[model samples]
Target chain A: MLSEFRNPISFARRSTANRRTVALIAGLVATLALAGCHKKVKAAPPPPPPAPSAPAPTASITATPDTITVGQSTVLSWHTTDATSASIEGLGPVPTSGTRTVSPTESTDFNLTATGDGGTANATAHVTVNTAPAAPMAESNLTEQQFEENVKPVFFDFDSYSIRPDAQSVVAQDASFLNQHPNVNVVIGGYCDDRGSIEYNLALGENRANAAKQALVNAGVSPNRLRTVSYGKEKQFCTEENESCWQQNRRAQFTMDQ
Target chain B: MMNGKKQPLYLLLLVCFLLLVITPALRAQDWVHTGTNLGVQHIRVAVASFKPLNNNAQTLPLKSIFDQTLFNDLKNAGIFDMVSPSMIPPEMPGSPSEIHLNLWSAAPANAAMVVFGNIAANNGQITVQGFLFDAKNPTTPQILGKQYSDLANDEATRMIAHRFADEIISRLGGGINGICETHIYFVSNRTGHKEIWVMDYDGQDAHQITHLGDVALSPRVSPDNTRIAFSALGRDGWAIRMYSLTLHRLVYFRAPVGNSFSPAWTSDGTKLAFSASGPSGNNEIYTIGANGGDLHRITAFRGPDVSPVWNPKTNSQIAWVSGRTGLPQIYIMNSDGSGIQRMTDGGYAVSPSWSPSGQFLAFAWNRHYGPGVLGGQDIYVMDIASKRWIEVTHGAGNNDFPSWSPDTRHIVFQRDNQIWTMLSDGTDQQQLTHIGQNIMPNWSWK
Candidate 1:
């Protein structure tokens, strides 16, 4: 049925029909005015107007701000005087008269259609989203290998989670990085020197990780952005029996994730 | 020849002397090994070289393997004083027709018992016939005669000899069946990563069982000799994994989210107990059915509890290590987590292995160890009846994870980087695995 109606007619016919209706309405108004003068009518709650032949439904949409920077939102408002159901093309059905906040990634045209006893009416609202310059460091999940490299391990004294005087500076540096890249979260892994039971090492590792995470928070990193997991003695960075190797294992490590 | 009365007295004196001499000989004939005497002195035995019945190219080689394996088994039985082959006469006898017990009991080879066997290798198969005899009482019946046939290979030959040797040990070395046929499961890192491996009790035919390219540790072979329970690191963190020895595959266990490891099985092979990091941040002991269901938490101490071992005799008691006392110590509790008792007073102790008889627990402890103490790790055996204990490995490199043999007379443990076995009394320490860093050995139940 829609295909039978040719193109250019939908817009042209609507305009032409609207003009002819206005002229007829002007003539009707003159006649009505004369009747009012003759009858001295007391405007008794005027009888309701007759239903239109094709239920002339109406719709309108407007974007509060036609364009927005990426990640910013824009409010779209729509109102239809005579319509039962109304929906926007890009969005599903919405109330006949209301407003909605939209955050589109690109320029998009939203067509609102209202249908009721009246025929359908359409309107469009264009929302343009501009991409903000790429975040200095794009927010992406770190690869396991990348995590291994970017996160510098923090060493501890023998059987100690207390940050050494020298180690304090290292942690502060880590805090600085975290502050700059607030979008990245980190898991602070605790470790041991492989001298205790695997279970004991696990708890000790937890203490170390918690200690490092606390230090980070103390240095102004968000606590929720840091996670703590104790590897215990299960994973080792060194295998030698010397103090050097043992020192390497007795520490907390920083690993990042998106 | 003299006076009549005097001649009668002389005849009675002569008859009494002969009767006294012959009675002891008759008693000696009836004295045989009935598996009753379990004395300190070793039972001397002789193993004659097997007769090669056919020239199947493998007959000579197989015979040599059988002879050596059987001889070593008896010698290692600890109850035997084996006669050296060089001491036996050059004449080799395999069957009953070719044997003479008198020769074994002779001067140089004073073996109280003798074992002789025959070997025959036919198309891709070999048959071994073994016979044990009492050399002391030649007129007595044969002690044991076993016939075994299998694929004609070095492995089959050694296995055949082990079976024959076990039968002899059972008949002559007391009531316990020798562990010649048993295998010990352990963790080896020679393959670059720790893997579960199996080897004969003597460390022969060592083969990798689980190729789980990760660090698999604390291997405990089940009672039925069909499965192994070990802990490995995986995507789920540390999990207690089960490997089917019979099916030669990994079986699933009802795993917990926290760090789970160190699985132990009940004597009846129906339950497994393990340690997992509990929600409270401390590792606690938990138990589940063998088929991987019906979980029950057995311990909820403030400190870490791990390495559970079930009493093989009662199947009602479990021994494990708990860190509730600051340092890790051994503890025992009933199957339902009742009747909790502390076994070790102080110092670091771990890896408790309950004896098959349910009489003792073999474990590694560092009693005199302190912050800087080196070479303090030693294996100890404590009788449950009395809190008394004896050290097994001393001054040896950090011994741990001692497992009891099926006979309950021997213990296999890890010393430093190798697997070693010794008598329950800590006498004859023999290294089982040498090429790889092996640890956490668990003797099979059978």
Candidate 2:
């Protein structure tokens, strides 16, 4: 109804102005469309990416025995392929590459990590916490008692003839046992590793025996009750040339005189 | 009466001419050899000839010194009627096997014993091979023996010949064993320190036993030849230590802090008598069980008393060198350290060692008899009962520490850090060692 009421002349003038405005609008739309198309093409080139190069994360993580016995300690450390771990669980970064001792806790697995490059490398350490093996118990008045009680109590350095300080107590104890039983006689038998000449080892064995006897006498044992003999390298508890067996052979033993 | 006096003068002149004619044969045959002959009256000995063993043709040092020694060893044996090699005619056969038995049979020699030996050089070892023969029967030569000995390259081969001479004496049954196998134990200071060394009687095959490089003195062997007791210093200090010849062990008995030395083992090998200085520095003679038991104080004295020598047979008396009279002297006491009697009279005498036969005591004496130069210490032997001391060695060298041989016929002592020996009397002195400067030779009973 409103369009029928409009004049022809007004309609024509309005139509020309509308045509010019429409052409101007069309040009602006074309320019805006071209800019949008240019943006789409530029974004397609950027889709290939600058690669995943953010620096490979170093594997500075390591594993260690989780639990150490009471008398022994185990080392726990971290390993990294490229970078090192700053610290683990606030224990502080291991300045040098090695095993670190954690608090003697229950046996458990621990996760260790190294934070660097693109990621963190982690390793699990199984610690077996155990109590130290008890030293052999000492007793008196048996045939083999002295072997276990006195000799077993004494520990010697590897391939050394000199008696250790810790072995003094054993000698003194044996000395006291002999002194207490005045009728009982004792002999300090010195032994050595098979490392020197027979004559030299015999002399060394004698020295070891003498040293034990001196210690016994110093502990108030009568020199008469205690005699010394050197077996040299003739006798050995263990003949193998390993640290474990050598430690067992180099010892001065106390035996009741027959 | 005038004719009878003229006849007596002519007879005396004729007797003198006969004595001059027979003197050459007597002088030519110096050694008076004794042999057990049931059928023969004269037993002849012929020393075989041989060529030098090696091309090294070097004369040993001290030739005259050792030649005299060889002469003493053989001459003293009294078994050989030694015919001088020069006395044999040049036309006579040289080697024992080459001997013309008929010529020797017609000569003064009957049943001649010939010694032929070869001296060969093998590396540093010398092999002396010899065979004894009856020169009267040259075809039947007896192979006496063969011995190989290690000797220094520079030593003379003459000792080898002397050794063969000794073997010849043994084969003749002079009743004395040859000294080739005998060894001499002495202390040597060649390493700038004293060590015990054992060498063959001829001063060859020398070897050091104690590498301690410390002062080792007064070495005495056991009667059984199984042990050697001497004094050595180690980390434990100066004490008497015994080395078992069989076990080769060094055992030190528990002694007081002060030097416990001068150990002399009993003949039974069960006990040892030694001079001990307590921590208080009171030197006393003490007897201890061989295994370090039952230590008994033998002497109670304030002066330094040492050098104990046990009587092998008596076992009741100990003849020791003591310093009781403000100077070192020889003293004898009971086994329990009672009834002490001074054996040596005046001057300074020490190291009294009783002979194995228990008849004589050997000791060393030094006197201030000269104007300013003090008398040099020399070895002396004294009769135990008579207490008459006879000086055995007399010279400028300081001879001390007389150690009697197991047979009691020879005494070895120390002179200038070397071992020397002489007869029981002061005669036939000879140096036994030329290297390492040996002292304190202890003869083994075995």
Candidate 3:
């Protein structure tokens, strides 16, 4: 027993006071037990008391609005048990049961960690923030994509920015839509076919955009709410080198702010 | 007996003296001979991989880049029948002493001209020594030997190659500057929206110059290559915007609301002419001083008049597309909006680009622009003096907006949403950009 206590690894693990007590107990036991001297009797020491284990903390987190558009806020409510302290990564340290409101521009996951005597418990709540033309100007009835589809492009004649008679109805429809949605701003985009130089087509397209814009203003849409741009034969809808493709290209488009 | 021995020794000394005097004279006579290629023949050239002068971290990498760049530039010059490097003999010549011209001129190589150079990159500086040799001539092989140094980087090394190649072309190709150093500014939608991009004339070192992240079109680099003027779709509508190349920032040009497109730089770089939709009305040509103020309206018409370009040579005249006659046609006028004359007699003509020499205007015109025309539009070059037009590109694709090279020897135009360059005589058409839809290619003047 005394030889066993002298082992370096076991001696290192034992506290200095524990080591001394162990040595003294072993020496006394060995000395008394070996008095008969017929055969050496082994000293069997009792084991130390087991430590009490604390339970792991439990945590739960839920978001008030699990889904949101870009620039909208959501609240995360959390509750924890058996935890000394709790924290969220983005929100920093928080009380055991509290809520945090974050208006993340993008979709993000909020993780809550509750730490206690035993270990830490983690719970995550995700907010799905979608990216569209999102925001104050968006309508519940229509999305930005649907708005673009509703305002059809007005086509033009070859080498001309003058709006064709066929395209007037489309421009009027776009104007009516704008009248209903005064909060929304629209950019009128003019485009030309791949017929002329990019610079020339750009001017041509700008003229086309302005023509559509003039029609909208004539139909009572505010000029301040509308802007114009020319793609100048830069962006094309089709790649075919035919008249059919060219006809599809020459037009005035619209984009609305959400 | 002593006198006889002295006589023989004198004869030997005389022989040595005669050989030395005659060899240099013979070499000079052979070297000074004028060498010219046969009628309309390609100059069969060989570009040797650059020899590194020192062993440094940048030496090997820069040497390979310089060599490869020079080789590609020469090959793309379109006037050369390049002898493949693999077929040429393995001799990395840095100087005349190391070159054996016979190895280049012989057998499978058959190289008429050879370009060899040494390169070194050290202490953030690059030193390049390039030599062009007419190997067909035995005596005086060296035609041009130039040394160029600049801040060491991939761009500088490529510039060195461009400058050296230009020198070779100038000495050989009847004095036309190589387009190697020229830059092509175009609009690309690679990053999801139309933004300005600039690249080497041979479509290398392509990068976005504008991060507007919006639609920007018709990028026109200034004559001095300092700024790029383009139209951007901002909150207030399409406005002309200038980006300073030196400052690496956007410059405010105070363009009118929804009115600016197709910015053109005057020859002196003093003024910019652009067609603007004036007064929320029809398209008109306008000129503004480079420093912004002094806006001069050049034309006001019922129909759209656009794509104004200054006559680079005179700077006194301007050419643009005017639609007064219903269909757009090429029109040339004096700088102060005087001397207006129609350059194109009829048929849809737009995007008139004045030649650098001021002798001709290259534009996109479809003689039969009516529906069912096989070719929707093609590039046409009309001499400003005679007004005689020649079709530069036909069918293949709808080609338009032909901008001239500084030398007036080549024209770059946009076709099928891609950029292409061809000689002024309608030959050697080469497509420059491929990835994404590239349009509005404006070649830098220099």
Candidate 4:
């Protein structure tokens, strides 16, 4: 019945319209016929629900000053979002977001990594380091003989390796000279007067050298710059049997290590 | 019946006569035994120069060497009061029929015993006839008679003299063997390097043993006299090195880690106890096999432990020097590293050498050790059981490294860069080396 009513209205419309209006009425009647074929209409089922997802992790790191001189330190700041764990190269493990002070002896790149259930994120901060200037060539241009002369030998009492009061001042001066000439490494030779057992004197001579070396270290000289050896009574500065000669023989003499 | 009774009587008479003759012979063999101990009364002895039997060119020289060696040996015996050669009669007895015993028994020659010998050299061969007589017993004075034949040389003649002198010493000075045939091993730098050297007991025929251009110290000859164990500095630092005297080369010795010094041998010549800084970098006493295995650490305490010497008589105990109690002192312990005892109470004492008899320890000590101490270093010998010590060397240019002669009656040590020897009681101090600095003298075991 609806199709019959639509056909009559379309016929009445077509009789008063031109061919274009009649073609439009024919298309409208065909749409009505197609709509009338469905007896009942129902809403389409909603699309499958989207999967649950975790947010991606983010990481950022920055050094307060990316450039530094040798022996200088820099502060590194970093932040991470949705991160369960974070770590920086050379700094080991760290809090998710924090700052740290690092003193690198050389230029280095500090890399930060943030890890979470979602994935991993990486960030890096490059630090530029300039080496300290070389020690002055004039200070390092000392000949071995000159070095020995500048660093006078220290003496010890008979049968004792303890640094005498007079020798203490000499040791301090030696240490000061050594510190100034940073490139000069020295070998301390301990000697003894020709009195006592050879073996015992050897040991005593070693003690003397060690005592002098320790004094130098105490006076702020780097221990790595000094070495010790014991000549005992094998090599003597003087062969006389008197006290003056013996005093000369019993000493801790310094020489430049090649 | 009459013949059998007569035979029994004859047998009894013969037995009585044999006993009468044998008893006096046994009594004559008995000698007064004396030693280096205190309160020993020395026997007065006279040694006449050995008469040269032939006028061959080698005869006089060999005879002189023999005569001098004999006199020196008797003098160094420490059990004899030697009569001056000038006091003896001019008549040199070459045979029993030529001597006047009464002359020796009387006057300035007031000798209780007399030693005389005659030497002859013929065609590069030498013969010596030595005799010892009891001057007090004029009728039966012959106590010893020996004949020695060897090649005509100074060394052979001296050796013959040593044998004869040793015979007399054995009969009169107790049954101890003489050290005349022994050698003294020492370190000398005369060759521009501290090398091991050896010389006769009487400071004769000194020669270098090791040619190791490196520094070598403290040469201890094994008891067998076939090897010398010493400390030497090498590319790998100080290590205990072995030199074979028989093979004339450096033998294989497992170099233990660290600086090893002062290698001493046990009496059996199968092990050596030395001081080495092991992995701990502290000096400790360790023992290893002579052929190099079974390394065992004997000391575990702190401080430097060095100069180990075995009680040669037992080979079960060791005497060493340790700085554990501050300043080195003499210490003794079992070979198995137990029952440690400090032998020295105080002061600096080191280089302990055990006497062959195992009753005394000879060491170098500075009793008043410290800055400005009045006394210098001296050699001391202490009785192990009594702990009583006697200063053997006093104010003698820093004497040290005292080594005991095999006979236990003499000690050879270093004094003022020279090798010296003295009696155990500190008498007869004689310098053995004069050319170069010689130190750390060790007497051969034999």
Candidate 5:
């Protein structure tokens, strides 16, 4: 035991002499430990908690009136409140739900509703009973799509007997609508842009108006439903500059034939 | 020294590990069309459509014409990963089925969307039905909103299809927006002389934009669609003039020493790119302010460089048809007229319309390739990036001067005396005008 104690004392003296070696080891070990700890901390930030589940939206329907006068629709609209998924059925087909389509029958109750979100609303439409409402006094108003389908037909291309496709739909749709509405007689007034000679545009405009009337007859509309007139490029919708105004002026208009 | 070695080694290893961890997050698929993870980088479009009926068997009816027009319109819109028609399945011989979501899915359209349609005619009337299938949502295929038009026996099926193409774009929440409605401004020889006329994008509701009856030609629509700049053969000579459609006003630019023709508008609507031949004695590219101030000549060349089309997005480069190469070919140079690179090698490529994406150009060239009117001119399009050229109009009639729609989906030009529109891919060439002669269709931008 006395010898061991003397040896340890000598070892302590040697360690003191080799203090740089110990310090170097200590520094290296400290760095390794710090790096390892840093990596662990970096990996510890956990992922966020999952979102709370939500219920699907519900669909519902509403009508202004349960019953409407004869020859009138009840104007019912379907609304979905909270249901996630909803579809309407039994209007035209199982797939025709949520779309606006006129009913074919005269006196049937429209059973329609949208279902989605978390809740549903229902609407019952009672179409009014009436003899084909004696063709109301002639009015010459038309919708945007109607302008494309009916009024575009009368204008002729330059020096050619050919008609372009974009304008044909306007003629076809107008003729079809005229056929459907017997009392509403219309005049197709053809106009031209400022591009051509006034007389040339007038003749072209007349050709266009005549073309629309011809299409109406072909589409099964009575001749009494339409007449023709020409206003070659005289009136302008966009009369300010270039093609923008020219396009608007080169059109056929529908007016009530009183 | 030994401890020092260990520390350096450890430091190096830690640095290597950090690099390894950071690399993957930096390189991920970030170029997505926003709102969806399934990004479509390429789209292929092919139509197997119904053929035309020949009431008069005397003339051979061309069946593929309408299909070509529709294809062209959709391709020009720049939304699809269009596939060529050759790659499409054989078209059904008769009526087509309502687009099935399953077929689109089975085809695995490179794009998550597909358009399929049918055209039928009887007794001088026509019907076209089309559908847009969202391959991403296979359960519901939207019946592309449509309008049924009645056409005469003489009307071409090709034009009807262009309208249908426009409808397809409108359904996608683009193209037919109010401002995008088609417009044409042209110098018409109708009133015993030439005058400027403007009309809807489809040639309806035409009105005079300029009452100046002096052979107005080469009308260009401003980027905002509110103004137009045109050159008229005035009493003095040719005059470059500006007119506002919204304000109904006209302003004349400083007439260069001689004449100015073929005016093009910069995207900002503040500048005009045109051709002016002055004391310089050569037709060179020049720029002037929208309000008629600050005239700057861009190209100082010996040859005639006319019809300058400025890209709407970058506005740094202008693509125009130049005779600098001895023969007319398409060329692109800095808006300042530097670093010019010739784009086309083919013969007589004129009237270059730079599409909104700036990746495709539509021009008219007379090809001696296949059948029909050998040496007659037709319009063609080239993909600037892929260098793929697709012929748009085929056969006898001359299809020239194509102006791309603002949405870049449709190109309107004149074939014969009437205006027509089609897709950028050389499909669906449809006529838009009927009475009187119309030409020089300039489409508006929203």
Candidate 6:
């Protein structure tokens, strides 16, 4: 072992082998053997242990199917290197590497922090939560649907709130439907064609709605089950500037009300 | 690195050099005081951009808002021939010592009046020092100097600017009060419901006033500006409703016998005149106390009579629309429904709004209103004494519901689906709303 330590110095003197070169090689070998003897003598006292140093912890996270609808959920998978503990932002302490199912009501960012003796590392995974479209009424509850299908809207003539003969029959049918469904309350929305002044049209539309309600009251339907509101020419059902479109807009629409 | 270190010093030196060079030249120049008296002729005014006094994050933005609002208010004052910003000197004079009369009174600017100010913000508060100068006078150029301090916010900054502009207007535009501080209440369907909404007279900072998820129309603010009298559709059908602005909730207004529409507040704020149908199914003009009692029928006409408006100047007369003849026409009568006089000779006149001065009546008139008549509804201002009317809007998408400004110099009306304002002589027309269908704008009394 002592000769092994002196091989580097002897190789340097291989080209020149004079007395000085031989003397230098012998000196280096003697010094190396003495250092080896000194190391062996020191080994018994237990040499100081090397200082412990750790590198920074690495962390990475991913969310599978990051985008989900309102009722759906997403999975967040994470992995960490050289971390003693790890935790997500919303969730408490978890394993160093694991998967978690998260269902956030809104858009959220999940942050993961991994801590170790060396350092702390962070990784973030963004999950986009989209609000689902408004759910339709339940299949068993068909009050609104029945109102739309059975309670027909009665049309009016130009500048006239008087229910026409044809509109009379339609109003009668509507009243009959309301009488049949006594549990349902209905709001009669009076609308007008996009003509005339807003204030005047509001008054005219109210007159039409009241006339319709009066007809229903005359037909055995309780007046308490009916309410009237005038839309006037404000919210138009048809925007086309034509006679047919105006006729379609000038009507008393029936709607289910709470 | 060396240049960056000395840059501020260089800037200071340059500023010193400019002041030394400009101050003596300004002092030595001839100062001519051009006499432009108010009410005689339009004064030529120059509005310099407000100087930002500091580098705070809120300073520049607040200054910009103040600058724009003040400029627009002065431009819309209807009595000033405003100088173009390009013609005026680029230098903004923040104080009396900084203003140069020769620079403003000379060639390109040729302004008789100059308005300048400086704005600063620190520690959540803003300070504004505004000045109006007679640009012609060198020794005594200051016309009006005012200072305002308020919370550091866009709204407060805007209000400070408005107050400053009103002061300038009141000083320069004869004795008429500025309408900049007024509000315009109208109907907007922006929130998917026709709710009453209010905004500044120049149409800024619009917000909903009522959360009644139904149709509300004809918002007439009380003379005191404490409540709004309007008609809303509710469970009992169309009824006149009162909303207390200070209370931020609906107050009680007893419904008359039939459906009530178009509630018009008297200038005294004691009563509201409206039109409602009776048992005969014909709408008639009716008056009720502001506290919702003492309902009385003012008109017992045979045909439909609706849309009543009290003469604000003299609360003894009212102008309303009557269909007693073949078509609707504007009529003026006494408060007790006597002394009936037809204002329009022919052709569909409705929605009469008496001017604050009681000299003119602004109404929506379709002179050629007939089948295939080839004309649309337009707004007209009529001299009540001579019945001589001037058409304010021509062929602009069926304009209607013209409400006179409190100043009597401007009119707000609904054209198509948006609310608009223009001078009484049909100039400087501006579209106020762009979001949704807005209609029936009523100017505040104050």
DockQ of each: 0.02, 0.00, 0.17, 0.03, 0.00, 0.09
lDDT of 5 by residue, B1-446 (tens): 45876998899999999888866543442222222112645354445454443443412242355565576666655555576555454444332244444454455334456666555565566666565656567555454545454563323465576667767666664434422335667656566455677765555556777777546677887877787888765433345777878878786456453456678888788888887653333456788777667887877754456778887778888988765433356888888878888887545567788888777888887533221123556777777766556676777476667888766657888887688876665555667777677776677765
Going through the candidates in order, what fraction of the true interface contacts does each contain?
A: 0.04, 0.00, 0.48, 0.06, 0.00, 0.27
Q: Which candidate achieves the best TM-score against the true structure? A: 1
Worst 10 residues of 3 chain A by lDDT: A1-10
Judge candidate 5 against the unseen true structure and give its global Cα lDDT, from 0 to 1: 0.60
Off by over 4 Å in 1: A1-136, A141-190, A196-234, B1-39
Poorest stretch of ten by lDDT in candidate 1 chain B = B29-38
Model 1, position B206, has a per-residue lDDT of: 93
Docking class of 3: incorrect
Q: How accurate is candidate 3 locally (lDDT)?
A: 0.81
* TM-score-based ranking: 1, 4, 6, 3, 2, 5
lDDT of 1 at A221: 95
Candidates' TM-scores?
A: 0.73, 0.48, 0.64, 0.69, 0.42, 0.68
Docking quality category of candidate 5 according to DockQ thresholds = incorrect
Give the alpha carbon lDDT tens digit for every residue of B1-446 in model 1: 48787988898999999999987764444213212124578888888998999888889988888889999898888788889888996777879889877888997999898889799999999999989998878777488888999999999999999999899889876688889999999889889998999999988999998888867878888888888888887643568888887777987666654667788889898998888766555667888898877888878765667788899899888999876645578999997899999998666788899999898999998774444556458888888988767776767678888899999878998887789998887877899887968877889987
Q: Give the alpha carbon lDDT tens digit for every residue of B1-446 in model 2.
A: 56776998898889999899887765454223221231443345654344344564332232233334444455443345655655443342324445455554455444366544445555655555556666555465554655535473434445665566666665675345555445677777889887777775546667877677666665777767677777775533357777777876676556553456668888888888887553223457788887888888888753456778888878789987654444456899999988899987555677777887888888877643211234467777878898865666776577777776554556777776677776566555678787656666766543
Q: Show model 3 residue runs off by greater than 4 Å.
A: A1-198, A209-258, B1-63, B78-92, B101-113, B119-127, B134-141, B148-154, B173-177
Error of 4 at A120 (Å): 8.0
lDDT score for residue B241 of model 2: 76
The predicted structure with the larger DockQ, 2 or 3, is: 3
Model 1, clash count? 1
Displacement of residue B238 (Cα, Å) in model 5 is 1.1
The number of clashing residue pairs in model 4 is: 0
Clashing pairs in 3: B31-B140
Between prediction 1 and prediction 3, which has the larger TM-score? 1
Better of 5 and 6 by lDDT: 6
lDDT of 3 by residue, B270-300 (tens): 9989888777567788999888888888886
> Distance (Å) between predicted and true CA of B316, model 4?
3.8
Stretches of candidate 4 off by over 4 Å are A1-188, A209-228, A237-258, B1-41, B51-55, B87-114, B133-147, B212-215, B233-239, B254-259, B275-288, B291-306, B321-350, B365-370, B373-377, B393-398
Model 2 chain B weakest lDDT span, ten residues long: B30-39
